[model samples]
Target: MTGSFLPYGRHVVDDDDISAVAEVLRGDWLTTGPTVEKFEASLAERVGARFAVACSSGTAGLHMATAVAGLSPGDRAVVPPMTFLATANAVRYQGGDVVFSDVDPQTGLLNIDGVQDIVDRARNGIRAVLPVHLAGQTVDMPSLARLAKKAGFVVIEDACHALGTEYLDGNEVVSVGSCRHSTMAVFSFHPVKTIAMGEGGAVTTNDPDVYRKLLEFRNHGMTREANQFQNRDMALDSDAEPNPWYYEMPSIGFNYRASDIHCALAHSQLKKLNSFIARRRELAARYDEQLQYLSPILLPPLRIEGCNPAWHLYAVRIDFKASGMTRKQVMVRLREAGIGSQVHYIPVHLQPYYRRLYGESSLPGATAYYAATLSLPLFPSMSDGDVGRVVDTLAHCLGMN
Candidate 1:
């Protein structure tokens, strides 16, 4: 606890990551170049997806996915209220409406029942379901996929917290982001994620058309393919054709491409993703074992029979009444002890903007989660002593001897 202030989450950069970025900086291209393509390919291979498109951020990936899926004004996308605002904001970015769903009270993951309720109640325009994998836990994708099919909606997984998580089927661990159960999956490469790349994201899809549209959308709707262009005769019509630079903009898009520098860093981080996930799980186990006797705090729910979490966050629920201290007070006490603690989310539905949009009402599960949740420091770089200090400080604050 004496070294320095601990953060709830932090990036772990190595010499290789720095060298990779330096190499990219020295190269000719910086944006939308070979390094970006290599990173996309690497991610697709790693996730077992047919295609992967790199973007400026996780929100950008979500927006592109929604737009490409034909979400537009008056349409609705179902989203869990327990996630970050971006999950719902992406829907609004495409002029689509957001219908808030509740989360599981214990896991803070999207409640399948709430999602089904929203789907059944939709009068007309609901088009997609964006289920978030909160805190790096994998959602029940197979079951959700069945619901999506029955409800006639596209499934776009907001997998920002679950890059290394897997969906288990008995003894087999099926990798997430493989799009095995959804139309597409989105991931964030923010500094706090399993693999850090400063600021970037990607979309993984098995559909080729969706992949092509994502590529075009991420790059201002510009396409280099002559075959796909509207006017084929444009190539033959000009003498100085500018090396077939002639392209078409069928839809208005954004310049949301990730830079080569970030891609290089992300590539290096991806190489160590497995080990990072392993370490996170190990730390989570330590917390579970040590904190079991603390009546004031509740650990995150364990994995179901067919799920393996990436453990991107080590969130615990604090019972203020039992602990004799509110969440904020506990957080302050922990900070005084030189440990960093924070809340994972303030349910999106309760945010100022959403309050205006949806109005304040009873969201029992999400509100409950918001009131109790706290994220402790968790990262691969944390040593055993660091873990001990965090647990000890928390125990002291909670009066758990």
Candidate 2:
């Protein structure tokens, strides 16, 4: 195992997953069928949400959620610069402006004060506040929701890294996709995520109207349900029964539906979420214990109270400058040792497209956090010995003991 290359993240698929997909492959329905509905229901129940809408990708879920939230031209949404570009781009996709907010230097999560400042200064046209649960850690959603309520904006969570993540809400523990604190929450099922669906995502919400809109937005703004159709004459048959072939497109939307094949695999993976999370927690703890003494070169993720992260990525901060090498140099050396590493993100505000669109803005925390962070190998299939080997190799590569 030591001689084999270890990736920063990978999916763990068993025979059961293959069997589930194979069953779907052998069935009649492959896209937009009963399997998709079953998967949606299971996800909704698991997350304590009233409705769950499955989509093709997390980015698609974000776009649909924003569309349903009424984001429009000239509208602004507060986005932290420390997350993936999709989080911010989703707003732009709706022709809305992205108001970049600074994140906590230590945790790469949005703080209430920073977000509040952005909202206050923007005054009018602030349509939504998107708080990303970076690295599987939940944000202070209760506080963010309160701020959104006060400012008359919606709160949609970009929870791509936090499918199984949980946090305390008052006296009760709630799952990340519950949508109890935010208006809607989104999740990703990429191969590297907590579960694998090849490429899938979902949005969870309790509002009935939003739920209906999400379904419409996922399928080209079209609906087969006669009750929702605007053209009643065309939708109903001669006997007043709904026309079986009738479908209406009321608004512009995208083809973002996840196929039945993907749903079957996702449903199977959902059954083993608890086990996957447990294994990840064990690996994270091992890393925490073993990497404690590598001072001046590394700092493990902060142990936040009241939050149980799903451990999507064991991202650690490394002082490459103090370690006498550039980040690229450190990564190259680690790769030479048959170990893979990655940077979780390079602050979105610093990206070329954003700079050309919004101009440069000062966000020191995001910049500092981006310069030091690194994601090491962490997945459910990795052994305890793998964690030890990663730490040992990292230390050796950095010229530390």
Candidate 3:
């Protein structure tokens, strides 16, 4: 590789971002302090949610959501195959069975029809449906929510890639994290995501009970609030004054709390989310314009009306048979040319563990999408020239002018 390597995604950190973290480091409490609450409040307000709980990672956030949704053994949750492992694993963490649903073969998005089929077949024990907003393109949440309401299942959105995405609710523009349709929505702040916090995540919800439950679940099921305490004697002194060190573990929970350092960095990064999304959109348009003429290498799937994607991944579908090159070979060639690419996911059901657990099941949509999808470099900091270079190199590797 002669030129600088271009990764599929990267974080953009400014001096101010460093300064925010530095300020936190200098503060009194580093783990659970005012900065943590401030960060949570900022995220909740940004997404128009009543509450937000910050956690250590996206997986942790998903686990917490599943816990709050009351998933247990014998309870089944619908999970689409075309998502990161964490999306499905979260359900398993709560001792729940996963019913793998298919996605749109073109868009790699969860198909509402596929979910409907699952619900129709299993009328009972369906506790939740997790719809992942893959590649920052939103799922048809309105339709999914209606289905959940009718089927008596909760809807939790895996919106890790869709921090800045928006869609329409009637004539109103609704943000992805607003939880207007779903019961809860989760986001990630990994370096490769829309924002970077080293490792951080948040879940947003409008339901006060769910919000309180999420908070309790994020911190070892411990509650500091005396009102929620089950044991009054231990939580209070003779004068009935709350004991400062007293806390109650009402339910088993994990230590998924996000630190002030991570939250501070994420809070700073959140301020630039709009601009970051705008730049990513600009880069996506450039890819579309330039790659249109290359045959057998299709652009990203067409979005439906009212879907304004955040463009986390500019994944194009290449018909490997027609292109006369395997996906692996193309990736090797691109790497030699200093351009990076990656596959968004393999079907979660096809995983060996899942196959062993659920047995072999056909999901043609997810299978087809996985076979053709290849995510090219896409991030806010890449320049127009970088886009041109990547396209030129990809075209050359594909033997197209």
Candidate 4:
């Protein structure tokens, strides 16, 4: 085992990025200014979406999107079980119920049939279907869209893991954020994501109404348009107008806006997104080639026929019974050998809060994944030597030789 520690994921920051944030800080406006708009425009252009709305974090973006979708009390949203709790928590933020769906055992993404089952069985004000692209793999959006259309469910993609992924359609590959099949797609720019911005996120949509709602929702339901307000000139007509200090709080909303500094960093990071994704794919390929002979560990599932993954995570399943070691034992041994190993998630439904709120019955597929899965180090910044060290450390921990 190597003496150096290998982490599962890390941000690749450069001097240029630091300079960009520094420049933003030196400017006049620090919050919700010109840089924020520029960052939104850049994100929209890159993702092929007509409009992008920046926010404080991925969870904030999700909440804003769900709000724009008109989810209210008594509404229900369908979500996959094999994802971070935020995916489901965003629904609860709007006082809506979350109906959990099972994931594909191999890819850890939502199963189309499982979604269909949930939509078919939904009753009492089911409003939207939130399909999470787990581990940066593209979900079957086309089929899911069709299902949503037939079932009268609004489709909101929790695309935090799939910023640069593309969906397969025979010979054609469509990007996930094009909103090609869903109403709105959300992305994160956290330190561990494909694009790191310290803390930020955005919502992408082609629908003008949804875009307008998101814009208003993110900024505390206040509109800057003079024409929309009853009193156009608040300062000038203070004595004549009913409420001269005038800004209509048309609807209840939250302050979930991103700062110009974070946006600046995200814009800089966006420039290297393609390169980062390429490197991630390269690393995944190396793992596949080297681990092919290791029967005790199952590598991540292959990309769908025409889909391209961003490769945010490289999770492997261990056959603990066959390997004569438990998953816990393997993880402990790997950490002791100076390799950083972690689990992506413990299915949303299995969490203490979810179990208390939704009842703690085991989801066979999600539980199976949680039991055997371990995320290995796979980031763009890793060197070939680092990759080798990770693989060798795992082999030693698993007692492969």
lDDT scores in order: 0.86, 0.92, 0.92, 0.85
Candidate 3 error regions (>4 Å): none
Q: Write the per-residue lDDT of candidate 4 for residues 1-401, one digit (tens) a residue.
A: 55677788889999999999999999997999999999999899988899999999999999999899988888999888888878899999999988888887767778889877766676563599888887788878889888878888899999998889987766677887889889999998889899998888999999998998898899899876555565445623646544544566678788999999999999999999999999999998888777776764656555665678898888888878778888889888888888888897888887888888889765687877777788998889898777777777777777785
Q: For model 2, which pairs clash?
A: none
Worst 10 residues of 3 by lDDT: 295-304
Candidate closer to the true structure by lDDT (higher is better), 1 or 3: 3
Off by over 4 Å in 1: 170-172, 233-235, 238-243
Mark the regions of model 4 whose C-alpha exceeds 4 Å error after superposition: 230-245
- Kindly report which residue stretches of model 2 are placed more than 4 angstroms away from their true locations once superposed: none
Q: Residue 198, candidate 3: how far off, in angstroms?
A: 0.5
Instruction: List, residue by residue over 186-281, the lDDT tens digit for candidate 1.
Output: 999999899998999999999999998999999898887766777656644456343545778877899999999999999999999999999999
| Clash pairs for candidate 3 | none
When 1 and 2 are scored with TM-score, the better candidate is 2
Better of 3 and 4 by lDDT: 3
TM-score of each: 0.96, 0.98, 0.98, 0.94
